[model samples]
Target: MNIKQADFVKSAVFERDYPEELEHFEFAFVGRSNVGKSSLINSITNRNKLAKTSKTPGRTQLINYFLVNKEFYFVDLPGYGFAKVPKEMKREWGQTMERYLASPRHKLVFVLLDIRRVPSGEDLDMLEWLDHYGTPFKIIFTKMDKLSNNEKFKALKAIKTKVDFHNDDVFFHSSLNNNGKDEILNYVEACLNGEVE
Candidate 1:
């Protein structure tokens, strides 16, 4: 899983206007605000500060694209959930993300969750919607270093019970230690490269 060359592609305010050509199998990361979406990406790609992590929430306003090894595009989408920003602004942001997730044109999605905390209501909502819409997605547990063995198992079990998705699609991950980074990246590359599943 060596990402020889990674580059930031573009940023978009709306999904409809986001690069019309789905030339590559794009991998999009979605989760609540400050759910380590940016940090997870940076850690997984082994690129420090590539995704722009911050202590503050709601900073990622648009959909950002990063090309990986010239094979697949890692799409860093705006995080949804509670934000420190204004209510009106958050509502607009939600709509923007929704359009992208529900898009029939797009292919794969990855739902990121913090390992220590239980799956929140919003997280469940997103998973349910993805299943209802039949979107191909997988779950990635982030920040595993903060959790104990028992806690990690509990989190995984709860997520499995709640998400109405294929069991094989569920994946465990930790971006901080780069555990499961290769598994995730390899899976995405396999899917995008049209290799047999």
Candidate 2:
């Protein structure tokens, strides 16, 4: 899982705009706005400014693609559930996300969740949609650095009670401290190597 090279490839706003050649597997990250998606991506790739990080929520409004080691892509889908945007814009975002998720090249999707809060209704809806579509995804609890050890335990327990996923399918991550970075990279490596489904 050594990242020898990583570069921003493009930003796509529609399904037809996606890379023409699907030569490599794709991993996508999706979550509500301001859930640390950009931070986690930058931390994992060891690139300070690869993915744009902003103080404002809903800054990522397009599907951004990053070429990793020239072998695969790390797709950053636009964050959902940002209410500040207009109704029509939100509708368009939802449609665009649905189109990308339907792509067959997506090997794995990391569904990010904020560890400090319970899963919102939008999050639950996403889980259900994934299930209906038979999309393979794993839940990632972000912002772990903000929680104490005991609090982390409690949060994990509460989340697990609500989600029908095994412990192996969940990861607790913190971009600030590089927590869960290695494990995630290893998982991605395994997937790329045909060792994981």
Candidate 3:
């Protein structure tokens, strides 16, 4: 989808005070530190710089919000697991992440996983937590361009064997190549409307 205008809305410590404007549907992107969450957001929105991409892990320490056409909000939540941040900062980040996921505001969260390698400890933990909490979420494996077609198939198959994903639910995407952009957009849009696509 062509984002007419995408702007940083606000970063909230608590979900209640996130943004009073619920007129728009909400969707969030989350994963481990530097798992290409920002890149994925930019790719899907077709905005090369909508969300800041950083080589430095854990650059996004806050719950960054972006509004797309005022129809929905795309949230760039803080990455968990592997931040080289300070001990005190990491503790606070964990707390922030828990609160963010547990809150009902924008209940639909998209957890991005790196397809180049198997899901990490924190990645699996997040998925399990979401499942335990009964939160609505979907897993999108990113960085498909790094793998050959045969390798991609094998990697996807491996992931499925481990995770038990339904057919339409799992996706393969390459942010650089702009693959699966349309499907991701449609999925998020459907979730924003509170309906299964």
Each model's lDDT comes to: 0.79, 0.87, 0.81
- Which clashing pairs does model 3 show? none
TM-score of 1: 0.88
Best-matching candidate per TM-score? 2
Task: Name the lDDT of candidate 1.
Answer: 0.79
TM-score: the better of candidates 2 and 3: 2
lDDT of 2 by residue, 1-197 (tens): 78989999999987788886556568899999999999999999999899999988888889999999988889998888864899899888888888898876655789999998788889999989988989988888899999899998898789867777766778878999999999999988888888876
TM-score for candidate 2: 0.95
Predicted candidate 3 versus true structure: per-residue lDDT over 1-197, tens digit per residue: 45677777888777675876566557888899888999998887778888899999998888888878877788888888778889899878778788878876645788898887778878888899999998888888888888898998888788776677875777667898989878887776666566773
**RMSD to the native, candidate 1?**
2.2
The digit string of per-residue lDDT tens for model 1 on 29-109 reads 999888889987887677887899988988887888887887677888888777788888888888878888877665688
Stretches of candidate 1 off by over 4 Å are: 20-22, 158-161, 164-168
Model 2 steric clash pairs? none
